[model samples]
Target: MLVEFRPHARLRGKQPADLGASVLPVVAAVSASDTDLGKVRVVCDWVQYRNNFRDVVQLRPILNGDLEIAVDVRRAADAPVGELTSALLRQSPDRVYLEDWRPGRDSCVWRFNALYWSALDLWEKATGRGYEQALPGGESDARNRAAAAELIGELFAVWDRLAASAALPDELYVIELGVGNGGQAKVFLDEFRDLDRHRGTAYYSRLRYLMCDYSAHVLDLARETVAEHTERVSSFVLDATRPRTSLGFLRYKAFLVYISNVYDNLPTDEVAQLGGRTYCVHNRACLPGEEAAELAESVSATVDELPALVHKLLRLGPVLLAEACPDHFADTDAAVRFWQDTWAALRLAERYVPLAGLDTYPLTDTLTGEALRPLLESGADVRMHVSNGAVASFVDTLGLLHPFGKLVCHDIFVDDIQGYRTTFRGPGKYDGSVVNWVNGPLLAHVGRKRGFDVDYAPFRHRAGGHVVTMTAQVRD
Candidate 1:
């Protein structure tokens, strides 16, 4: 049951007669309890909307009414005079309205229909559980556990691919942008512990995990999550859409940045600043043009080059791991065509080189043509590229061997039609990309321009889907 409120009778000035006729009756109907004149308590919260300047009021009655009343009001924390005049004109005669709402006020009405909450509700409806229930924890859930294991395995796999001639950094700062319940974080931490046992304590101690989010409520939840790890993790509250303030950049310098389900929230410039090694995951849902329009108004910039923003982020760091819903692209051929066209339109054909010699590269048996051919053959379509990672070593090698080379390695993966369907089920969907050398012969032409030695490990993998990871070293 949802209740709506409008301060303005029409669009401009309040129509007192109309309010008395239509608005008051609606409020009275919703607020009326078991008794004819039952009282309803209104909770006022200080949070205000940009367009409207009215205090949010929530009505709770002792007895259920025929209609449940929920009023959403907007007010400015700091507004000039007459801001609440229109809102005040629409007040119910018999109902008590809470005034001057602020944070920590129990009377403030909470925003219940936020996007995060909506997504949670949708997930709950799909999974047959309360939205508040914790997702698959570190143990017992085989599918989630396997996904975690695969992600951890990819970290090293990516390292091997990029570290061929370089050494691992002394410290790896990993920041997960949208860590919902820290389920994946826990799995990664567990894997790191295992690696410590096998490699050395020093290797483990040098690794730090930071989970960032926009909501203070979510940040509070993460505090408990980090507490479970006990000194192994920490959390921060941040708006990723905002620019990297001096303080933010100081806090976020790291070997890798891991963002899950956050790309849709950021503008291209913000994404570009998130350079350094980064791994991002997002669904295929296209951002509504209106939403983007609003963002542009606030940020004062149009999002004309979303793909370029992606490319910039990939190049900022040597290795990047990004995932999106395959629904964004229509099919494998469509996916290829999309990139081909995207690069052509951007006049950046020379900057991106698809990995062609996939067979010669050390690929897992599961990643073979027998496993991937069907998706290509069946015409699997996608809304966005899923499971993307960039090898910085490849980037560096291209830069060194071909000074003028601006090639970026990409691995394209399709999961629905693949034999290893287990990998696609845990997460929303699966698509893969890798650095293909056969498709990138222009490398020699570009490599001759510059030559320099870079120390990084060569990435090696037994299979394609095993791990989507990349690693690179930055020298002082």
Candidate 2:
């Protein structure tokens, strides 16, 4: 049996074969790998093996004639070796393949992600709380008053320079994507107005603040929060990934595009360079047949029918789903409850396939996978999020910036390639949405290529957190 430990640095100075020796007895007794040999992989943890493992001790079939035995080492270590081995040896009696393992970006997890935003009202109403409550501090740091003041101060200086030259536009544009509860926007606009008055400038009156988000409910809530600045605020329910498609008129006009806790939530795929071969990680979302049957039974349905019901629930929110399937769901609340349960039990099965070539892989419509080679080759065996959606959004949003403008994002960012080796960078769930650390190095590389400077610094307002401030501006 082949064993792999992750963060990979976990086995520092040790051989894979040597580190796997503890399980040799279990392997010998089962002789599970005797027939398939290298086809069997014993994975150590879930952070790196999330695609392949869901439980403390579990087994999954990799489509390419391989078997995966996944163990949560942290949880499994306390159990008797025999008990752990027995758990491993147990066949997945009701396991069912839901989708062919595909790239992380294509996984069904994202469908659930989109559902969270589209159905935000129902989810929040049913749960009696907004999604922002799920954040680390039960709120975002993007609304920090001092941070907003500093940013507004900087923008004022830029506007001041242009005003002196008689080049300032009549309508100053500041677009904020992913406006959470409008706390950040309120802070920003409040500061901008205060600063403008103090500086004796007209920039505040000239400001056009656009609040954009995927959920109309979120936008509504944010709009209400910033009601005091309603005249200056314009809200749009646009997909964050395709902002340029909606804000095309603002091309080369926006002075400040602010994004916070957003890039990390966008869809991303993961790539790994191991043993000198690069591979793209693929995943499939599935419900263990046993769990499916149980969840189905709770809803008076069958296991085989669960997947379709789920797709329906995702495409149509619980109320519509309940109305459409009266036979299964007793009411909207029941349907919403079922949706919650299913999401909690959702699992992703993952595998790595050798990349045919980097050039053939598409990073975005404009950028190709070839752009990732340098980052992937920078260190030892490493797996990192491609941040596909984030990259597309970043590059496209840059086009919306005036040459003197800037884009500032506050989110989890992996500032150095070496950071990948030392830590677990997400694909973690934030409420019902997905979160992955934005690829800082990759973003910097593309920014420089586009004649922009991208830089990162730890978020200064908060004393302890992973949030970083990424600023992209035309290179001087």
Candidate 3:
């Protein structure tokens, strides 16, 4: 879809003029080729001034192929062109997916986006692929299903805590920033039903959850799933970084936000701007061998040029900051060496001098509480706990453990008590399996590093699989 904004020539000025006497003209256009695409054009009709108001006119065309709008303005001739341009640009029309389209004024754009992404995720899962394989370790349905169950359990637990605190709003509207699918929402709904029964009131009506995602296909699946539960759940298609343009209502309404499994895809500044009482989750994987090799090579080459390249780019400075090396893989030193060697090989082929003395961590141990304690102690809040789950043996064992696990209790902590069963499809095979990376190492690291109380529970589904859910709270 294409969108553009243009302001009429009449509203440019240096000194403030009476906006009430001025009329501003604006134009917006959007185009789309997809049959399922839905678009909305919002044109602010009036620019409110300190003393009075200005009428902003809007023109809409009827044909569905493309949208072109024009507005007439009669404003002060000395008005700032930048200000005028900014106002018009803010209202640009864009093609939005059907999942993100809200028919009335009461639309939840964020929810629609979440649902849209979730639907696409489901399709990817159903199809056994994704746009890109960014993480190491092959994808598996068992892993995704187990992860979904764990995520749902976490959401329910959070809701319970909020409810118990008695500080929750009478009407809770939750917007999960990166809700991949309705899996977590489903868990929330189930928990809400139980909470309703316990509280002896229709708590469901007071609660609304929305999922926002970037993909329309995913939102469709999320919408379908949410519809099966209750109308309170909805989906929206949105880009997280530019949510304001799509989810203007969020600025006026208060909501508890959840961002999970999506932070790695965003930059730090963008993450900081996502305001709200938010629960954020991030997962990082070890880089694949090839990518790691490339990284090491680049670093080595920079070092060889020495004082110039390293000092200019790699050194810590006001204008430039060195990029942190990816914290994946078993041997940090070996990974660095691979890069250095690759660089040396390149230099030798070109008959250039080699550079040495690049320091690298030789430790083979997996990242532990001790290693990460410095980061935690540096006064950085632990937004979310980190975990790794690529161990083949642990994954295989989880499949075995799933069959016997009983769904004992599920609230803040999903507890399933049962014995182990063997369901591992073997190496390279994708099946739903849960392992120690989630339950053991991750829980341990968070608990020890952040001095947080942690709880681990096993959930057994009648369908036969074990999923472990863990919760942690940082120390006061």
Top TM-score prediction, candidate number: 2
Model 3 lDDT per residue over 159-239, tens place? 566668875457655565555445656665666566567767555677767777666665665577667665787677776
lDDT of 2 by residue, 225-258 (tens): 9999989999998988899999999999999999
Clashes of 1: 53
For each candidate, the alpha-carbon lDDT, in order, equals 0.32, 0.82, 0.33
For model 3, the stretches where C-alpha displacement exceeds 4 angstroms are: 1-168, 173-184, 190-199, 212-215, 228-231, 234-444, 447-451, 462-466, 474-476
Ranking of all predicted structures according to TM-score, beginning with the best and ending with the worst: 2, 1, 3
Which candidate number would show the highest lDDT if scored against the true structure? 2
Each candidate's root-mean-square deviation in Å?
24.2, 3.7, 27.0
Q: In candidate 1, where is summed lDDT lowest over 10 consecutive residues?
A: 268-277
Residue pairs in collision within model 2: 51-350, 102-282, 102-283
TM-score of 2: 0.90
TM-score of each: 0.30, 0.90, 0.30
Judged by lDDT against the true structure, how good is candidate 1?
0.32
